[model samples]
Every structure is written in C-alpha cells, then in structure tokens.
Target chain A: MTVTLASLSQQTGLAVLDHLERSASIPVVHGLQAQGDLIVIPLPVIASSVKVWPDSHWKDVPGEGVELLRGAAGGNPHTLVADPGTCRWTTHVLDSDQLAIGVFETSAVAYLLHPEHGATGCPPGTYVIRRQREHEGQRARLVAD
Target chain B: MRREAAEIREEWLGRALSTLPADRPAAEAAISGLYHLIGLAPPRFHWVSSPVTALTTVPPGIRTRPSETADRVSAWPLPSQFSSLMRQLCLALDAQVRWGHQSMDRLIRQKVRSPLALSTEGSLRMPLLAAHDSRHRFQSTWYDTQCVSWIAHYDALRRAAGVLFTPEQNRQLDLWAAVARSGGWWWPREGACVISERPVTMRTEVCGDDGEVRLHSADSPAVRYADGWDVHAWHGTRVPSWVITDPSVQRIGREANVEVRRCAIEHIGWASYIDQAGLRLVASAPDPGNPGSELRLYDMRRETRVLLAVNGSVERDGQRRRYGLTVPGFLDDPIAAAGWTYGLSAEQYSLLLRRT
Candidate 1:
C-alpha cells in the first residue's frame, strides 16, 4: 500500500502542515536521513563513536507513536511511528558527542514525523537517532529546529 | 492531580507576573497580619512605583541604620522571621499531606512548584533582584519567601489534590496567598514597611513545558514600571534596551557577558551579524549525512570560529533557514567543525545518513 503524508498523519494522530503535499507517497530511504533537528544514522556507520548497550531495555513502538524529543520551547515534538511491533526503541546508548537521543531497531519500515518537517520513512534496520547541535561560544547546544 | 497542579501553577504564575495596580488595602491587611503573627504591630505603609524606587528612596519618617539600609536587603530580621514563619507553615501543611497524597505532593512539586520557581526567577524575581543596590551580592531568601510558587504549592495541595489543612493552617495560608495575589515586592523595617507596585506593563514569552514564561520583547522594554524604571530582554536573557531596539555589531563585540552577547548577535540575525562583523571565511564543505546542505566556517574572534550551516528542511514559505554555530578556531574543515558540535570526528559524522 502506498503511504502518503495524510495517511501517515491519520495513522499516528499527528498533524502536518496543510501546505505540504499530502497525497504524494513518502519515500522510504534506506540511507541516512535527517528530519529537522533529528538525524537517523545506521548504527554501524558510527559504530566506533556510538554504541548501544548490550542490556538496553527496549520498548515497542506503539500504534499511536513514540515521542523521541520535543523542541526546547515546547512546540513540535519529533515522533517516531510504525505499525505496532514493527519497531523497538531504547534510550540506552552511549555517544562520545552526547548527542544520541536513542536507538531504534525495526523489522519493517518505520517513520519519523514532525508537524513542520512532514515525515520520512526509514527502511527496516537498526539506527541511532542523534540530535543536531551547534556551538554557541565554547559550549555546545542542541538544535531544536 | 498533575493536570490540576499545572492549572494552579499557571494561576500563581499569572499573579506573580501581574501588571494590575496593587490592591492596596488587601496587601496592607495581609502584611499587617504577617506582622501581628510575629507579635508586632503593623508598621506605617509606603508604596513605591518600582523596586528600584523602593530601594533607593527613604520611606517617609524612617531613617535607616547602616545595617538596615537597602544594601543589606537580605539581612533584615523581619524578613528572616517571615521566612521562618513560612517554613513552619509548610511543615504543618506538609504533615497534613497523608502518605497516599505524599506521592501526589511530590508530583505537584515537580510539575507545579519547580517550573513556577523558574518562571518567577526569570520574569519577576530576577527583575526585583536586578533592582537590588548591589547586583548578585545579596542572598534571595527574602525574595523567595515572597514568591508565590511555594504558596501555590500548598494551595494546590488542598484545592487540587484534596489534601486537607487545619483551620489555622488554612488561615495562615490565606494571609500569605493574599499578599502574593495583592502586591509586588516588600521591604519591612521596625516602624515602617515599604512595598512596591506592580509594573505598569510587561511582555513575556512562554518558554517551558509547563507554561513557564520569561521576559521577552523584540521592540521595547520587556518589563516597564509606572515610575519609568524598565528592563529589556531578548528571549529570556536580560539585556540592554539597545540590544532590543538598536543592536549593533560594535555593541555586540563590546559585550562581555557571553549570554548577552549571544542575544545581541541573535537579535541582529546570525547571517547579518557575520556579514556586518566582517568575519573572515575559514572553509566551506558540503555537510555529510545532510545532502544539499553546505557548511561554511568563518573566523569570528580569538580562538573561536563560527560555522554557518543551512537547515535541511524547507520552511512553510519553502525557504531554507541559515544558522551559525561558534566552533574552535583550530578546525579548518567546515564538516569537521560541524561534527565537533556533536562531539564526533569528521569521519564519524560523514556516514551515509539522512537529514530532513
């Protein structure tokens, strides 16, 4: 079945901009993709710098969705959604940059949705979700686009 | 319970940031009751338009000793007694919070109390503290004692969570709540009590999960008092009026406080700041993992560089936004500088990935 933004939003009970093309099917990218301030990276690609704990407690992604992160000023949450049991998520991970928000492993395609960013599909795989950051002066600050 | 606590928290925050004319009689009565609780008669009341005026002017008929001067604002014994009285009241109310409601109390503390405290710090207390004779030199217990957060905490405990308070505790709580709901800051002396009126106008932006707010206005003073005292802020950071009304590259360069400097630069827009400040170009590279986005690095100042990157996503108007991040000057590669922001090496960040 083809998955458009409207279908994705309807399935997850999330809202997207009316201006965004809602009828076109969203692409399920097999490679790394960034959605606003969140980046999805194949775990092995950054295996040297990031690691998932061997005993990490993982939870199934619900039909409604799992909120990965919210913008610092409160609006616009980055929600990860997938068919129930298709994706599992865990926040237990180590990153040298301290930017990793969590790790997700999927048996089938999963999607990351944001009100402003629309949605992007992640093909079945294990990936590390990292937040984007910027240095203000000497200190690094997370980007909440 | 958490939801109701949030409602009560917002209600108190509204009172804390109130701009209405102070309820003179209500404030006087509550303060007089507080004075009586300490076994003393209410002192003569004098009202000022702002905390600055309250601190600077001598209330009529009062001569301050060296120790009782506004400079020693936190050292006043009257405030200390009131602080003790509030603590005692909290202990009494806390005891009434049964074991079942103890967990609810803790939840309210986090959801209601803590966020309100932060909002008060940002919107009200900080301004009051800024009005102190010596900035950053005095303890803030007296100010904290007057803050409505803790008062609202117990109020929420009773009204929202259904926790009970003794009649006496309720009476005492009513007095404190009335004071909070009625006026602004206060300074008590043996024979005279000075209080401040609320600001004539104020502006703020909600900046937290629990509806917490901070002083913010792009064009004028975020907070303004009837007596002409006012404060400007950018986002939540207290800043000079120029930073809001007339931010200049030279002024941003001269600012010593990094947060204030950052606010100025942001007010000018990062892209414009880079151009106006004449930051030197260091390097440029296509950002790895985020295709189509280019990273450009510029030499900002001593030992620090700025990385300019394009956001991966398109905006509602279909334009991509550009933002800058300061980085160590030693990194010559823009991609590496971008990677460094996430505490990763260039190679680690270059992995085939996707950015929206």
Candidate 2:
C-alpha cells in the first residue's frame, strides 16, 4: 500500500485511534525523494549502515552500499526518520486541520544487519514485515531480498 | 478537609436555595430529573402543607419539600445523609453519562471533591437525550450536573431536621433509595448491580496499513464511529443494594422444603435476604433431578435457620406475602447475601464446610 501526505491527511482521528489501540506496530514502505525521483529503500538498511542524520546525507561510501538516486541526485533531500521505539501511536487531533501522525527522531545508522555480510552491509530495496499472521508476543517477519 | 467540607456544604446549600421559586413544580422537576438520571420513574408524592411534620413519621416512601419553604424541608446539612446523597447521585450520574475524554473524570473528581463545586455551575456538561412524554402535565427536563445542586440543598435541609439512622438502617435506606431511583427493578446480578438489561459481547478488530486484520476480544462494550471506537464496560456493582427493614426479630415461620445448591465457584455461590413483611433469605437451590438450580427459601431470623422446606411453592399469610429467599448454601453468615442466589458446585461444600 502507498501512503502519501494527501492520503494520510484525509484519515480521521477515530481511524487512527482504532489502529493505535489494536495494532502493536505498523509497516511503512519508506524511501526518500531527491530532486524529483524516489529511491525506495529499507529503514533498517539506512539506520544501521549509513551516517544518515536529520539534516546531513551521505556525501559520497556513500560506503560500499548500493547507490539509490531519485529525481535529480545532487539536491538536498527532505526525509522523515522514525525511531521504532520512540514513535507514539495516538489519534489525538492536534488541530482542526492537522492530525498528529506521530513523532520521528532523526538519528545516524551505524550498522545494517545482512544475512551474508553480517551487520556491516547496506542492502538496497524496500522491505516490510508480513503482518497478516502476526499475534501477541509475535514479531513481524522481514520480507526483503 | 473539614474546612473544605464545610465550605462545600455552605456553598452547595446556598447555590441550591438560590436556583428557584421553590414551588411544587420546581421541586417535582428536580425530583423527576434525579429519578430520570438513575433511569427510574418518579415516585408518587403526596403533597403536604408541612413536609417536615409529615416526614417525621413515614413508611417505605421517602418525603421532601421545595426550597422556597426551606424550613419545612427536612434532612439537610447532616454529614452522613448529605455525604450519602452525594455518593448516590454520583453513582447514578456515572451510569447515565458517557464522557468523551479521560480529563472529564479528573474534572469531576476536582469539582465534586468539595461539595460547593458540585453545582450546575460546574464545567461538566452532561446532556441526557430526553424523549417527549405527553402523559405528564408538563414535560420533565433534568440534567445530572444541575441535579447536584438540588441534592446538596435538599440534603442540607435533612441535616437541619436532625435526621439520624443507624449505620445498618442507613444502608437499608440507601438501598431503598436506589430501588426507588431505578424504578424498583435494579438488583444484584453476577456480582454486578444492574438494572434489567441483556448481556453483550464486544470484539475489536483493526485493519492495518499492510491490509492485515487483527482481532481483539474486549471486555467493554464500544461504539464504532468514523474509524474510532469508544469502549464502555460494566463498572461492577454499586453499594446499598441491601434493604434492612424491621430489625432482626427471630420468626420461625412455615418450612418450605427447598433444596439448597452447593457453592461451587466463588462468584456463583452467594445469597441475599429481602425483607418483604419480615426478614427472609432469597437464595437459589440445586435441583437434584434437573440440570440447573431451584429456588430455596431460608429464614435468617430464626434459631433453626434451616431451609424453609416448602415444595417449590410461594407461601402467603393473609395480607402478607412470604416469598422464598433464594440464598446460596455456601454462605455461613446470612447478612452477607448479594440480593441474588447462584448455583453451587459439588466441591463447593468442602470449601464452605471447611472449618477455619
């Protein structure tokens, strides 16, 4: 499922509350927009392997990872980095027009876990957890190649 | 706290008295609203020139007059009665209104902490959906928040009259008040003080961003609206369900040969005594041949105190009706009944018979 600012802004507070009350976690297909093109990538890939901060971007090991260039690859990019631990799930309406989705912390990724390259490799591509069969005390499965 | 209570009492009384012309209509409106808040019908009130004199000697029905003739109204300003009224009103109000925010509960606590703040002037807005009734001379309208002021005012009058009751008798009065307020149908069921209502089950399910469906079993009943759900659970039982009429006078009446059910589970094993003319145990008995339980009668105010051995029959004496008390066999103390009875398990006897 694709989530855009328009689609998210249209959702009601009750819907948001229902999700927060019953769901342990949500799966988001995250990426970044630069210039104009979009670079689809897994959150764990960047949070663990790159020196990605709130304002600063990879200026070029850009490491030994896959180079994902979207739109014009040279312009400064705006991104939202959410710490899975700190994000609050609520349906509180902050204002009449603006609904609070949640808060995200911008932090640097020091290591990325890879099946073959241990915790030092940064793999490219969008990844998400299979939430269909998830139950209490059960963790989501990483569905990324 | 004493000073605060004093302030509350003073302020509440002042606000209550100030709200009216204090006519029969005004008094009736307040009383009607209080009854409606608790989902009860208005009791038949016989108008008297002086309610103070009339109420001094009374039967089952309680009496009250308007605030205009302030001196005529009895049972005001007494701590025990006033506090009891406050507590009762709070309970009834809680059951009727559904709040939108948790902050509302906190606000009520703060406002009602001192009785003075518990007036219609308080910030709480409790709007009860009133339907039209053409039967009455005039349509009755009452809000729970507004009723607090009246309760304070009337109870202060009761205090001034120097009305007093023993703790046990007070408990009975409270019970009678609840019954009267709830239109005489509210009773104890499954450890819950509930009006006549059916049971319900609530299930919560969410569709995740990944299109996955998650199911949850919720104990509270919830309302689904525009993507949000508000849950409401039965908040256990309210106190004062016990009515102690005509103090304990041992009377060993007819023997109703009723079978007593064994107390199996803790929640199921209970009994109660409702004093109709005199004290009689109301309990459910185990059916030896049938699968479920039966109605067994027990008289608490007797030396024998055994199950009234009546063969499944309601015994009546002339103008007096002697209904069998459906009490649980597990209860060692007769006074501990919950105004209802439950079926007991076979192993429950060991638990009950076990001498500690």
For lDDT, the strongest prediction is: 1
DockQ (Cα-based) for each candidate = 0.55, 0.01
- TM-scores for all candidates: the values are 0.93, 0.19
Off by over 4 Å in 2: A1-28, A31-96, A106-145, B1-130, B133-177, B180-356
lDDT of each: 0.85, 0.26
The digit string of per-residue lDDT tens for model 1 on A1-145 reads 8888899899988888887788998888887677766778888778888888999999999998999988755568899999998999999999987899999999999999888878899998998989877656667767764
In model 1 chain B, where is the ten-residue run with the lowest total lDDT? B129-138
- Model 1 C-alpha lDDT per residue in residues B132-207, reported as the tens digit of each score: 7344747888888988889989999999888988898999999999999999899998878999999988898877
**Clashes in model 1: which pairs?**
A32-B353, A32-B354, A33-B353, A33-B354, A33-B355, A34-B354, A34-B355, A34-B356, A35-B356
Judge candidate 2 at residue B192 and give its lDDT.
21
Per-residue lDDT of B1-356 in model 2, one digit per residue for the tens? 33433444545433332312224444444444444444456645444222222223332343322431222222232222333554664455444334442343333334333333322212111001101112122211222223444343233323432334345434433443332232211211111221211112222232221111121222332211121222221111110111111111122122121111111100121232333334454444553321233334454432323232112111232121222333334444432321112112233221221000
Query: What is candidate 2's CA lDDT for residue B226?
Result: 22
Going through the candidates in the order shown, the clash numbers are 9, 38
Q: Which docking category, incorrect, acceptable, medium or high, applies to candidate 2?
A: incorrect
